[model samples]
Target: MTTGRYLAAGLLAATALPSAASAGVTVTGVSGDPGFLTGRIIYTPGGIGGNAGTTSADLSIGRMKFTGFDTATAAALAFNTYCIDIFNYVQNGTFDLQTFTLGNAVKEEQLKALLSNTAGLIGGAATLGGKKDISAAIQLAVWEIVNESGNNGYSLSGGLFQVSATHGSAATNARALAQGYLNSLGGWSAQPGFNFSMLSAVSPANNQRQILFAPVPEPGTWALLIAGFGAVGGAMRRRTRTRLAYA
Candidate 1:
């Protein structure tokens, strides 16, 4: 079978299996894709209270595409994800996918709000530049929500989370864009069809935790699918019974 076919078959099989505490996954860079943005970010030293005393470094942001095999069955699985932990870096190697919990209720709620509301801004950008801007902005917002302490509310220009001005207009504009999105969270309700799962690396404790976004079937839609499957199964059962009787 072709490599793509093998990957598809493996993914299908992997999804059928029960969820494991940690699945081995590998992450690599994605090039030539508008969905993934490449840009430099510089955080001010001691700017975020939670990440205090850490020196700033030039970092890139955007959606990460990863491909790996299931630990139990060796089935191939691939997906796009975003970083939630800015303190750690992503290495190109196998990492175990572990369930992540924010522990802080406020941070968890805010992150959910950001993911539910701003997903369209990233997905629906009309141009590559626009998409990159939104993608960077989302990453900034995520970092602020996850890492910032002392809770001055989420903001890129001020508060516990702040971006440095040395990285030029790209970094400046991204922070501003991110702040705009954070401001819109007030009175915003969680949107349907948006589901999020957090993944962390088990072996290397320092690897960044990532978030996966997926579209979920609505309750009504799932009911229809279940009914359709039942009808097909009944027809097959009836066919088998008739064939046995005739024989």
Candidate 2:
């Protein structure tokens, strides 16, 4: 093969390799403070005994902003994420981005359904109360899908995965709303252009894992990346030709 052809092939191979960006993530803060439901989560394996129970303080349910480096450009990337692990705590620390398939098949399917359909329901709400209620419900639904033991279905009451609030009707309403979303998943259709990622913490081994959603890059974006590689190969070939002429 000619030198130019070899250099072009090398550039293509390099672009096809996985990104070498650092996996460190920092939880900046909650996104929009949509709202939180006041309740305790009961899971035998999540460090909290089924008898003792744990409140929202222990398992915070809400959208959070996470800052990390882009896998391709290594640029600062900040996006919204939702907690998927009730067994661990969320702290400002380091985390690694993993594939979404790390969880059970049921968990993955249910989460995709929730995010695709019910997650954006809050955007259509008319009042602050409505928005907060929808946000809390989405979070509750996510918890049920991730931590629930039996694949029977998702629920916030009377199952291996349970959420209860002893104080007011807000929690109760949120639970009902969440259950509605789960029930509708039977006929849910998969949506395209959505990319899901799992953010697993590096330290504090017990830190919570989060789900980050990003839109897939457009065709134009891919074209630009390919063009960039072509430019680099062209520059190298030009330099090689100049050296040969001088020789």
* Per-prediction CA RMSD (Å): 16.2, 18.1
lDDT of 2 by residue, 1-247 (tens): 2221000000000112113365445443222244433445555443331113443223233333333454445555445445454433344444566775634786677667667665446667798677666665666666666567766566666676666665433356666787887888787754676666656656545445555554455532210000000011011123222100000
Candidate 2: Cα lDDT at 157 = 68
Please provide TM-scores, in order, for all candidate models, with all chains considered together.
0.66, 0.67
Worst window of 10 by summed lDDT in candidate 2: 5-14
| lDDT at position 98, candidate 2 | 70
What's the true lDDT of residue 202 in model 2? Answer: 61
Scored by CA lDDT, what does every candidate get? 0.44, 0.45
lDDT, candidate 1, at 150: 46
Pairs that collide in candidate 1 are none
Model 1 misses residue 185 by how many Å?
1.9
**Model 2 residue pairs with clashes:** none
Instruction: Tell me the lDDT of model 1 at 72.
Output: 57
